[model samples]
Target: DQQVKQNSPSLSVQEGRISILNCDYTNSMFDYFLWYKKYPAEGPTFLISISSIKDKNEDGRFTVFLNKSAKHLSLHIVPSQPGDSAVYFCAASGLGGGSEKLVFGKGTKLTVNP
Candidate 1:
């Protein structure tokens, strides 16, 4: 059972355009949402994240929003650059109870063209 899902397999955006990536989850037990970015031949790097208690979190050009009632989350990258192009994965964990286990979505490949 895929608890987390990234419906879109890929997304393309022009450089300097806003890129929005969406994610959904079926598991209501998740209390933490995380976004990770992975480059070719490299491990997934930690990106922005949001807690179940927070509706939104922003860091620089990246922002993450969590809608607990809708069991949905999204990542927004403003003025997307080519360097921001990567496979973005959405992950969730029951961090509220100290559980380290994480459920991840299949990921969406983002291509930002100049």
Candidate 2:
């Protein structure tokens, strides 16, 4: 069974609009989240992150919100730009587990139209 899931496979948003990407986890032990953006040929690049202890974290135009009780997390990008169009993946890991490998969800492809 997949521990992490991005139910939506694709999302489209107009430039300058808000793009919200959602992820869900089945493992409560997951204490951290890493959102990565991948272009067509390059490796995934870190976008934003959040720890289970905090409900929200923001950086520039990107914000991440965690709802521990619901096992859900979301990444919001305001004023979405064309450069933001990519495959976004959600990876989760335990805060201090010796060997709990990172669990990644199937990415959601985001298309930002200018």
lDDT of 2 by residue, 1-114 (tens): 999999999999999999999999999989988899999889999888888889999999999999999999999999899999999999999864323577899999999999
Can you give the lDDT of residue 47 in candidate 1? 92
* Candidate 2 residue pairs that clash: none
Residue 101, candidate 1: how far off, in angstroms?
1.0
How well is each residue in 11-108 modelled by candidate 1, as lDDT tens digits? 99999999999999998889988899999899999998788889999999999999888999999999899999999999999867425888899999
Show the lowest summed lDDT stretch of 10 residues, model 2.
Answer: 94-103
Error of 1 at 65 (Å): 0.8
Which 10-residue window of candidate 1 scores lowest in summed lDDT? Answer: 94-103
Clashes of each: 0, 0
In model 2, which runs have C-alpha deviations exceeding 4 angstroms? 97-100
* TM per candidate: 0.96, 0.94
What are the lDDT figures for the candidates, one per model? 0.93, 0.92
